[model samples]
Target: MSEENKTYTQEQVDKLVQSETDKIRTEYTKQIKELQEKLPPEKDEKEVDLANRLKALEEREKMMDVQDELSKKGFDRELADFIKSGSDIEKLTEILKNNQNYIPDKHKGTETTITKEQFKAMGYSERAKIYNENPELYKKLSQ
Candidate 1:
């Protein structure tokens, strides 16, 4: 039959369409697989968020433990924020010992008599120092 006059039967046309559809589908599937292989595997959002929150909580717990250690060692609790030893009490103690000169003495020389006016005029650190050295004197002055 002439090419112009040739016509595909219903079965032949359906087969042709199916073959073309299969090729296109296969090509798209291969491309999707290749792209997936090239990219890093994605983590679930909920899992990632949970991991971050757990990390934060662990850090906070370490900090709290360090601060408790500092208080136990007669150092200021506030110093825990500055310390980066992460929960190693011995390391923290060694650090404090090495930097003892920088840290104020909790107990200095004998307490001297100061009036209420003088105590009131003293800054927080000075007052804290006096209180640390002698609670009775601090109470008397404060009263």
Candidate 2:
């Protein structure tokens, strides 16, 4: 005896494909749910997003506060960002305290000039010599 092979109609083939697709989808969904259950409870998406935003805002606020405090203490604008990033307020304060109103030793005695009253008391030759040496100073004092 010989057996004959049977061919499936297009509609039957489509139904069979649809059933397999549905079965695979159901299995995948079940596996995904099981994996999710194995993990710890998660925060809501909105809550997680808001928390991250809040943290960033707090950091920005802290940076601004540091900048303000440094500026008020007369630190140079060029070094503000470096000091703010480093976040060492005490070091900044120490630098400001040590360097405030600093004048180098070389600049100490270079401002000598005779006033009009002092020049008037000097001898005629001395006045002429002083005027010749620094005419600009003499002119300023004479006024």
Candidate 3:
């Protein structure tokens, strides 16, 4: 057996993890401070987290990513058009109702797509359908 592949003791792993964490903490503190300062005063941490959440989702795509699935599910043009075309939150929520499963792993566990149970949780009832069985195009966005 290779010496490197041999199981390391738990104590050894803990030391390595602690060292890497300390390194990361020193490197990230500056950026965290800057982000905290730049955020608007009226915005709460949860709101900022939401914005960051969407930004992160928009930043990275899985192999069969959110956009790809959404396009395949025929939800992209409408969703993009909704967000870009200045649709209201209610309108956007309605659009999200389509393919509740159209949501990607990256956005799973988020309230991005609203369902009947979700609507009930929020005291909402119905939403407009916006699913296309098959979209003519499946384009990936640039990071």
Candidate 4:
């Protein structure tokens, strides 16, 4: 049973979810490719950050491949964006694979995905704090 006037049936909802997930995955992949091209092999910090972000996005694709048990709850766009911000690919990947309300994958010892909202929910005020702490590094990174 769906909410009042919910036009989407279970099957329709599933397809729509799949489509959105697929789109995110494709966009993430495209971003990764772009970042890889942008990366300077000589180890520029910003380049590395961009590369790592790309890798994190690549790992995020697996979330789309999961059985979306929370279809009723709909996907969290903010959470999805937050999960992509992970510093290390493996750490972020681990978190995404273990989030609540969402269905678990067959593979155990998985990483849970984080959403932008979840990150916000977790209260990360560090970005500005870090920038304020080190204006020069922040300026360089921003450039």
Candidate 5:
């Protein structure tokens, strides 16, 4: 039939329009997909920022936990940063126990009192030893 003479029913006209629309839609979809593949994947700024914040918060929590554990174990909480044992409290405790000797003891014994006359009688080496041990006491005695 001649195209000009051809008459399409409503159903036929609807089908033709639908088929063309589908083809155009498919072609545009394919083009969009291809362009997307060629371009770098976009990073969601808010998601990345949230992930970083979460990581920081997790680290802070872990550090605080370690400090609390240190305090409970009678170790200096300041040692939390120096602890190599990640989350293993047992290993941390063992390490602290083994190296307990290295940690300074804050408890001081009664200070030995010496009269100025006794200080004067001390040799240079003795005075030097006392000075090295307690400079304040040495200064007091020396004066």
Candidate 6:
């Protein structure tokens, strides 16, 4: 019983340590399982990613729509972000109507292309003159 006189086999000490470690591991495992069971099921990674992507696409589409509307009204495209965030279309439209960014497109109502019937009515020399003057216009009209 004296100090330095007692000796325990290495195998016995190892078994004792392993038993204590196993007990701790088992308790922690049980607790972890219980906590996990109480929690709601996790969403699939793919589903979460898809949902995020879809939201982004919708936002982008909304922004594009706002830009198109603003452009159609002669407002600067830079104002698209402000209009896109506004929930009320009427309010946004009114704002755009009053904005300094508004610059009426000079070519808006002026038809740049003519129908085949109109082309047929024009004389050959007139058509030849138009073709020679601006071939791109003739090509667009033909389209």
Q: Against the true structure, whose TM-score is highest? A: 2
lDDT of 4: 0.60
Which stretches of candidate 6 lie above 4 Å from their native place?
1-10, 34-49, 64-79, 86-89, 92-143
lDDT of 3 by residue, 5-112 (tens): 899789999999999999999889988999989987787899999999988776553322444544655565435433432234345556668755585787566455
- Higher lDDT: candidate 2 or 3? 2
Clashing pairs in 2: none
lDDT per residue for candidate 1 within 1-143, as digits (tens), equals 99999999999999999999999999999999999999998889998999999999999998888888778888888887788664566787788789878835765664666889999999999999999987999899898
> Lowest summed-lDDT stretch of 10 residues in model 3?
134-143
Model 1, residue 66: distance off in Å is: 1.5
- Collision count of model 1: 0
Candidate 4's residue-wise lDDT over 78-112, tens digit each? 44433333233446445666774585566465365
Error of 5 at 112 (Å): 21
Question: How far out, in Å, is residue 138 in model 3?
Answer: 90
Candidate 5 positional error at 95, Å: 4.5
Cα distance off (Å), candidate 5, residue 124: 22
Residue 112, model 3: Cα distance from true site in angstroms: 82
TM-score to true structure, per model? 0.42, 0.44, 0.22, 0.25, 0.39, 0.38
> lDDT, candidate 4, residue 101?
55
- Candidate 2 lDDT over 1-143, as tens digits, reads 33366677999999999999999999999999999999999899999999999999998787777777767767654565676554486786778789989999977875766767887788989868867987887777667
Error of model 6, residue 93, in angstroms: 4.5
lDDT, residue 63, candidate 1? 87
Supply candidate 4's per-residue lDDT for 28.
Answer: 100
User: What are the per-residue Cα lDDT tens digits for candidate 5 across 92-134?
Assistant: 7787689977745577565677889999999999999999998
